[model samples]
Target: MRIGYWWRLAATALLGLASMSQASETAEAGNLVYTSGSQGSALHLGTRLDINVQGLQAQVRVAQRFQNTSSEWVNAAYVYPLAEDSAVSGLKMLVGERVIVGEIKEKAEARKTFEAAKASGKKATLVEQQRPNLFRQEVANIAPGEIIEVHLVYSQQVIYDAGEFRLRLPTTLTPRYIPGVSRAELLGSASVHTGASGWSLPTDQVEDAHLITPAQHHNTPGRLLNPMSLNLALNAGMPLAKVNSATHKLAIEKPAGAAQGVRSIQFAAGEVSMDRDIELSWLPEPQAAPVAAQFVSQWQGERYAQLMLMPPRELAEHQVLPRELILIVDTSGSMAGNSIEQARASSLLALNQLTERDRFNVIFFSSSTHTVFEQAVAATPANLASARQAIERMRADGGTEMHSALSRAFDHDSSGEHLQQIVFVTDGSVGNESALLTLIHRCLGDARLFTVAIGSAPNRFFMRRAAEFGRGSFTEIATADQVQERMAGLLSKLQKPVVANVQIDWPQPVEAFPRTVPDLYWGEPILVTAKLPPWPSRSDARVVITGESAGKPWQRELVLSAGEAPLADVGVPVLAQRFGREKIAFLEDEAYRAGNSEQARDTVLPVALQYQLMSRFTSLVAVDKTPSRPAQVTAKDGAIANAMPAGSGMQAVGYPQTANGLLWHLLMGALALVGLLVLNSRGVVYVRTEFTAAAGRS
Candidate 1:
């Protein structure tokens, strides 16, 4: 009977091979499969796949050709070929005893209920028993005739974390299976094989065979299977080797003379830990001398004098007056996950920071807008609690209609007579950044816009530009955990404007002038620096600065007398632009180079190199040839620490720590303890639990 079955299979395989050869020839000749119908149930193009199966092992090769018969360029859109139901149900990949993929679902009713829930807009959450190292989406951008190659390597098990996944390979097995072409086929069979390397154990000592199936794919009619399975044959005669339970590492010692009269032993390298250090620095160095005279000239006559305007240094010592503020929060679909959670927590923290004298309103926006308070309400406990409750109840949904949100935020009815301010918190994913800018141009007043960008990948350019256009400050909350700290720091800056509408005038023709100064947010002092023409001694340089104060105008003049001292010519404008451009370029380059490797290396590298060269403005310097390391980080703790010396319109501020780093250390220690327990159970170490009959013996 076995001989007859083998002969029958051989004949069937020969016929299949012959048909596959013809299909290959046709595919090589540039045959195309065009779109057939506009409606459903149409004969969409189909392709014949040639699969080679040998004793429970299979290799599949598919040659698909798509054509765009439509007038417009048709996207090769959706083309999915299903696998045989029974064969896939029993399939399993084995790395030791763990099944990486392919476990059939036992409960049909439960599966149907899950499918229903998923279809009904309920969240489909899947736990990762094993994670794959490379999770590739099968379909992306497929142009007409885009003959893409989709390849996958099945492994026994995989590991996963919150951000990444990992795959584990078997010791001595290459179990490859061919994916079938039928969308609905239950009865399926693959030829079985017994080779020295393919079998879980030596073929000579083969004992029992077990087939594993993917749990999610079992009995489910779907073209895509996440975890595929494999068949394994164990050696019964050979005693299962005792593996050390404490180590969590597999230990295998080969039988004597198993291979070429030599004994082989193997051990798994448990876990790996790595550390990476990042350093940031600058290019050229500037002189230590202050550029006060140069900054005065550039701001002599400007429309927004508040930006360059400076208050008395003594203001830091004085108590700031009570101000009214509005916090605009974006709770749209784009902010649905972690972003919305972070925004809510940050808003609550901001509310808590408000003093009794200050008044505030909280506005949440999705497709529509809602306010916690109609107008700015005093920072009373009752009002603040009400606002906090509203923020807590906010749910992320709907489209990102940002214009409507901004319009409501800047409406005259929302304004307060006392220091009016609007704090816009969002991930800034709106498509209409330009439109928002136009609106900001029209809404310019005493109100300043402070932006809090929340998310890993945020639209920094839009947020920064909006803040610039609205005469406010821009801040990024890089992580959900860091939202509260970053938002608080930003609010601290909005307490009072340090300088307003500052202007500078030069007596002699200065070599160059910095066109603009960075917006001086509250809690930050304003400092503008400029470069002077080559003076024949110090007497040839002088500049005048003018700006508005607390409802008043003021001016300041500085003189440079020509002397025997060495005159250092610093290009203040160039330095300022270099820093600004570098920041802007960083955001742009990161966006463009999101996933493309070659383009990022070719384009962003050169730009980053140039930025590294130009950032050295006396105070900060880049020591390494590479732009990765920053040599010295000056402390900006004091009031004047971040203040740009007279001529340079740039401030060197310290990167703030969002959360206490010490907390991470504690968390890591806990993880290490858990890892130790896992290792101990594997017999790598022994743990003793001591217990005594408490007072009975006494």
Candidate 2:
């Protein structure tokens, strides 16, 4: 009897399981679609950035405004991008004429505080780090037809590359790919948050996938929801020869001098759609770049110094040792347009740099990985021709399986005869950065991995970190026009190391930002920031640096003058912030390698708290305290969607949130239950037939 009852129960369960498909589909589809149709309207967002330049540093103030056009209270969340190494220092919430300053707190505690404020009818704001370059901001209890403004400030050192000073700002983001074993928990939490977009869902691999993946407007013919205006004050501290925007149209207001002085620049148009990255480049007068510059400051009885030392560039010599070059390309759907084109061009250029003695292979990956050969082959004419044909015929489709592709790149064990160079060509559109870096570090045995960023707005944080772990270099090719120049430059650096075995010695004990430095490339500088004790005398303190160039020992010494004029009042804080950030990064790396979350937290918390900075495990929060809204009316919250990156594919790629191993087992059990029912029915009919036949015979 129990068995029969179980069979009946099983049949009922199977029907329920079959019916769940629709619900799962609906939930996974996001908030844009319902049984009725598309959503009514979207939350509007606007941004303004004001920048001030002082020598090598830039201080920026960003104002983000949110407006609710609907007839109900709405809570909004926004995720945006910033420079990879930015030092976020301040945040304020502006409501009416009052301002609420944000304070740094532990990440979990900040979330709980925000949630509590949200529950009680109070206006609150919270900012948390999603990635090194990505952040999420939450604003609660915005009444109907309300306008809320959020202001933030951060400091970052400008980029100096190839005799030019450059500053880049990312205005849009390409959706990232997450690869890991799926969990059943993601599907059940889809509806737990309001104001979510229709494009993504939370997943096990990327817990905040829904937060990072914003709604994209494809071919919409209206004013973009997120339009940004940038104003920059350029103070290069030297005579400027030229200034121009590499990626956008800009209106330059030059100063009243000849090729010198500060310049004011703004968008040529009033504001621009957030579709591409903004890059501004300026060149100093010929042969006028500083080879070494130092800034010193004193605060709270401690002396701080930040300096840059550009090693003299070495002439390129003939290649003596052969190399093995492994090229890994991302052919996922996200690379369907201009990104693929750039990657193809980059691959072709890399092929041209290979010599007859070198060996090479190509690995292309999306949902699955494909290789041109089982192992690397010599750079022969026939092999090159075959590779070109295969690469050109490839098309973009399917999800991004980045981990598998990376594994394929590292599959071949080196015999220690030749140097192995893995050139990864991608947009760096993957969210699981920690996992990827961990994997790379584990498999990166004496192999240098250079990342070729292939799109306008690649993930800067991921690309830079990957290069750091692989002990290589990173370069970006934003457009096809710049491919030749950039790739040629990269090839020039591959002949030999500019400097190696770099070591710095201080006259006394001092704390420096990086305990160790990477090998230097041609024309690259060694920049270090340190905190030191008060020197005995101006002439007595000195620093000695040692390195090797072209198998010859090289050394330089710099004397520290404690009585020298201070650089700026702000320099001390800037130096301290940079040092703190590096320390946190080191601790996080150690934690990742050992898989010890507790250790990471314990080590990083004190430093973060002392510096009052935002980090992966720490956040910035602000509360109004006064209950602006009644407790009875809870605010409705949702995530605001970001604009679709220009030239990126419209097709989406990721694993199904509802599909997992446990679910598949239950489905199989249901199928077995149905089979048993059919068998029992057949048995009953056969018995009845036999009994009837016997009765007739009697």
Best by TM-score: 2
Q: Which runs in model 2 stand beyond 4 Å of their true positions?
A: 1-42, 184-199, 219-222, 257-261, 316-320, 561-572, 595-598, 652-698
Residue 664 of candidate 2: its Cα lDDT?
33
How far is 96's C-alpha from truth in model 2 (Å)?
Answer: 1.6
Instruction: Score each candidate by Cα lDDT.
Output: 0.37, 0.70
RMSD of 1: 29.1
- What's the lDDT of the predicted structure labeled candidate 2? 0.70
lDDT of 1 by residue, 1-698 (tens): 12222233233333333322111111111112121222111112222223332111233332222332323222221212121100111122222223222222222332343334333332111111100110101111222332332222221111111111111121101011111111101212211110001101111111111011100001112321111222212111222222121112333344654432122222243211100000011111123112131112221121111112233432352445577778899876556566678788888888887888888898888656888877788899999989989999998665455777788778735334477778888877543344466677677566778888665335554676678667778766645545655576676677665556766676665423234444344434343323344545445355566665453565666664432321244212222322333343343334332432123334433433332221111011101111211223111000000111111111111111111111222233344445555766887753432111110000
Compared with the true structure, what per-residue lDDT tens digits does model 2 show for residues 97-198? 879988889999999998898888888999988887888888888876678899988877777766778788787777776443323245334332232322
Cα miss at 369, model 1 (Å)? 1.5
TM-score of every candidate relative to the true structure? 0.39, 0.85
True lDDT of residue 257, candidate 2: 72
Error of 2 at 4 (Å): 28
